[model samples]
Target: MTGANKQRVDVAIVGGGMAGASLALMLAHFCPHLSVALLEQRALPDADASVRLPSFDTRATAIAAGSLQLFSELGLWNQLRDYCAPIERIQVSDRGRPCGMSMRAAQQPRASFAGMLGAVVENAALGPVLHRALAQTQTQVLAPARVNRVRMVADGAQLDWSAGAGCPDTQLQAGLLVVADGADSPLCRGLGIVTERIEYRQRALVTTLGVQRDHRGTAYERFTDAGPMALLPLPRRDGSHRMALVWTCSEEDAAILRELPEHEFIARLQKRFGWRAGRIERAGRVSDYPLSLSLAREQWRRNLVLLGNCAHFLHPVAGQGFNLTLRDCYGLARALAGADLAQNSTVGLELLEAYGRDRRLDQQLTIGFSDRIPPLFASPGLFARGLRQAGLLALALTPPLRAGFVGQAAGFGL
Candidate 1:
């Protein structure tokens, strides 16, 4: 690439999905003087259009209370609230067993926002809101820009990218390069970052359900012999009561579930999930994703850092994957702010190392919580079942233990 096509920035973020967009917004808020560029391989949705990225699909994300606070600080809660359904309570239960626990936001005010434990928002609405906010910031947003090559240079890293097939490639020299290109990241592979993956051999079947009764701002976590299922509240549309469903099961079961007719699927789901959310009236299109625990060997190096699923892809049992990533983004932005990147190298090794150290505990706790919870609940053995019941009983009976679980689930103590 010619010098004319080359540019320099303090930080160049690859992948403009939720992770990258949120990080860009955070940097703009926390380190306003630093130059930042966000690059996405796909074309960004129009201002009035729907987002088509994989991250912003038919699925829904359960934003923890702490994450909501971060977005509110960014001045996004107003717009976000319009698309969100507040989660005032959470109901956890086993399919056949009576022992279970329920958590209410009122009981744990420290881990709540405006009387809400958290809120759920459809990814379609969330993407548009985030991108719309990014338009008001100083960060440069580049879509249809594919980075074909990356090389670690003395200053930091160099990226060669193109707008499309006919366009000439442009070179960008960044003091810090952040990879947020999702799991099994090709960019990470090219950079020699290896990911340790543990496949559960299960798939999460996701869909939206229309219920005959109101969800009443309750999120349900039901454990069954198949696996764990989560039914999170969603904003009602056109006088209909709706909820988002995430049902995890073995691969063989998933294949059978995916091919079943809507009515048959609802019947099976109702039978497996029971009457916790009331009668299921209608169902939307179903999608399934293979489950796994994927952790990148390195989250940060000299002048480079990894973000989002590219860094650590966890099981979605606890709805912690995106929230954890949000925390990571915020932490990195705060570190950059304290370092005053405008006056020094943006990709200083010492600064990056400090940031990683600060984030280690939160990452470990959240990853472990997501990794170990499903199997313990899914086990069929008598001892395992007894243990599950005992744990829930403790949480229900002990205020301190329940509060601790609520705090962690709400994304606080970071």
Candidate 2:
């Protein structure tokens, strides 16, 4: 082991996936004077678009318009514009049921979900753009390296990383450290931050499919006894129009769904999904994951703050995880600009406190929103089902309730 380098930076961020990378770029581009060091375990990918990404595993993200505006400000929107699809409207309902509610851009809209509220982008495709944006900025990226230990003290935060073989260990001391390592963050646990996780007994089978008819830029959310299924708009890739499908079902049933033949799987999906768009065809392979909500005991602690999944992992029914974390980055950046990172280093106690305070309302609301929707539509009991059905009918006919729903989707009126 080498001696401690004792290097220092204004902000040291661990976990360079979407959240950490975006934060580094935001800070460097918007607050250049602040020295930012981003630690990403994966090797920095080549920016050449001609390079082929792995097939049968293209994950799509529904990006809100506010997130797009952030990307646009970083000059990334134009780079990503060609590969993405806009969601001009979103249809929320219980799959195949005649009575339901819908929301469209023209009915009530905002700039955050793209022109409507959000745009869906392939995750693999977007990663490179964020990397490119970082490469062009002043941020110092320590790729293929990760923190082995995080020591939070009264004075400041100490980060120790074991570099790749043939490289060396690193010790970075910063006033503030952001943890975007993900929901199961080792750093958070190491810091004695207990996270509460609630298993929904559901799993989501995620994949893309070719629609029999045009999506017309509308995203669909339908709930069945199994769980809530969403078909989000996707750009035409590999010579076919695509939409990302997130199908939630009981853990055991999800396993059954995963083993079914492609044709059989699509047939069952069509039965519940109905033929709203026409004949549905599988566009890619499916990937399944457990669904849960994980919330940290606190968002900030002694010069360290958790962002993205590390802070809160939502059910994805509302498509709020990434967007909510981006807003955290937005809020923290503003807090730093308005206050002092230097003085707050020891605890950043004041800044962190404020960030925590401003973030709580949004966090609780989004988490609850995503958590409640699935159960509301999935319950089968006579009373529970009736209540949900009645609510849907009232929401469909009532203007105020419909407008409120739209406002919430637009990232406001919460």
Candidate 3:
């Protein structure tokens, strides 16, 4: 509702969550001359010291070594270091089975190539840090703005959105449209992009827990009949070791566990996860998310590209969801940097093709691996169980195999 009803930019990003914010920042840092706009329905929360975000309230994310390097290159890692808990080692095992495999960062040939294997950061901490970094950039941010429609014009694409905070209902035109919306993306649906989906009939129970003993910078992945349970390390607070818990199980069981008493819930988790990280003394708020694989059959159009969960929703078995998206955004940034924005439509097509070609292999490898691992562990059949055990044994006995696993976990596929 203002004088300037339209805006023109070189790039327009929909959904200003972790992935969208990241792409905007990358473009700002690497391709400063390009005009970029980040459209978000939710307003960016203040990154001040006194603020606490509901999104960051009880969740934590594992950032692979490769992702950390990208943050470092953008000069934002220093802001995030204080909130990060480094993961120096990882242990994976089948519950009640003797077969298992472990990897230590120090055992790698180039131990310090990327330092620690990975790190964990609470969402409460990560969101603001990213928002602050975005604030430092020249990218125009349209928060509390809902996209009403998207039209592919002759030159590029045009977006119409209504903003809150007394802002105008504006229009945006850009050569490139980067859709980083989450899994249930309306934009993706409107664009007629189909998703190949597989419902796993499982729900992930996510919470933070206080451990009796130190986690020692180690992350644990315990596969059981219920599903895969991951205990990722978090920094100690008040001398208590904290670990992020992701336990997957049936929907009925998840509903029961979510309603159980904290002590009782921890007890059940302990019975399944064992005492690897010491006694599970207490738990924070528990939340559950349904598990499914949603992969967009087409990632790009003439002037559009999809990123993050909208592009591919993984099982989260190996904590590769966000990491893989980070790599995709990285590739897009590199591609855009070399393209000519003056020839909007032609360059947009060129960038989309080049970016898709460069990212296809990595996407296939990561998505295929994520899809396969969960089923192998979830199967209760004797042959499946035996295969799981044998695979673990092989991983333990073979150094090159172990190295490949480590590389994949660290965000570098074999």
Candidate 4:
């Protein structure tokens, strides 16, 4: 490639999944004057077509009320609401125990949106909506473009990428580089960003289920000896009631469950989950992912920042991972909204540092919340069981405790 082929932008984002796409949109909205480019290894879906990326698989994400407000700001709520099932209530329980707690949106109006605590949307549906919105923005979209190398430059960072094998590489220079590639990021590894990881030794089995009756806009969190399970309401399709399920269990148990016949699997699920959501009539394909708490040692450098799963990968038990990332994206976009990146090199560094400091408390609390819940409820010992019961009792009986829990879960005041 000749020097004339090299391109420069104010910011370049790697990875066009939910995190990258969202940060791109936010930058366009908040920092319209800044030139931005988004690069993705996978080809982006057409405006009217379905998305087929790793992030847009059969899994579903629970968008908290705060996140819904952020989407509304981006003018995506109208398109998203059509495909989402509102979560009007949340029920938390412990298996084989009679004590449990439930939270209703009516009880905490501040933690809800249009009387909804949150909403669940399948990632497949979410991806196209996001990409379609991106098509209208000024940010450059470079899909099927693989980044082979990245290095720090005097100005910022430079990325060498190609369309495919034997294709000439193109160099992209930017004032700031946002890395949103998924966990175990190659770019981060090349940048020498160390990650702290804690494997839970459990896998989350995910699938869509056909339920016998309506879920009534309720999401259930059930904790058992095996692990934690979540049943989130989903929009009805073809007149069939459906819900998304995330069941966490040991590797051995997951292996058995994956191989079980449909009837046997449903039977075991029904027995374990109880009659809360009524009978499970059917299930779609099941997929499993290993659970872990992964945090990057450095989220920001002089000319770089980490976003999404690359920055922090939290357990999904509290449904907080994506929401936290959304918050981080918003914070970073706001910090860089009107900065003069070209005229002042130190401006970017100062803003990135401030963003990191502002996000520290929220990230710590949310990560700790997601990490502690599974083991606390999964414990079989007498003391742990007693603590679980007491916790449930406090949440059920105390309004302050309930409100605090609802606010945190709903992504409010942070």
Q: Could you say which candidate leads in lDDT?
A: 1
Better of 1 and 3 by lDDT: 1
TM-score of 4: 0.96
**Taking the tens digit of each residue's C-alpha lDDT, what string does model 3 give over 135-211?**
88888898888998898877778898888656556888897888998998999999899999999999999988998
lDDT agreement with native, every candidate:
0.91, 0.79, 0.86, 0.90
Model 1 scores worst on lDDT over the 10 consecutive residues at 49-58
Better of 1 and 2 by lDDT: 1
Indicate the residue-level lDDT of 2 in model 1.
Answer: 68
Q: Model 1 off-target regions past 4 Å?
A: 48-57
Model 3 misplacement above 4 A? 1-3, 48-57, 109-114, 165-168, 343-346
Give residue 22's error in model 3 in angstroms.
Answer: 0.6
lDDT of 1 by residue, 161-205 (tens): 999998888999899999999999999999999999999999999
lDDT of 2 by residue, 119-162 (tens): 88888888888888788887888888868888875666888886
The lDDT ranking, best first, is 1, 4, 3, 2
For model 4, residues 1-414, the per-residue Cα lDDT tens digits are 788979888889999999999999999999888889999998887887754423222678999999998999999999899889999999999999878999999989999988899999988889889999999999999989999999988888889999988988999998889999999999999999999999999999998899999999999999999889999999888778889999999998999998888889899999999999999999877889899999999999988999999999999986999999999999999988755555224335778888899899999999998899899998999999999999999999999989988898788966
How high a TM-score does candidate 1 get?
0.97
Instruction: Return the lDDT, model 2, position 360.
Output: 81
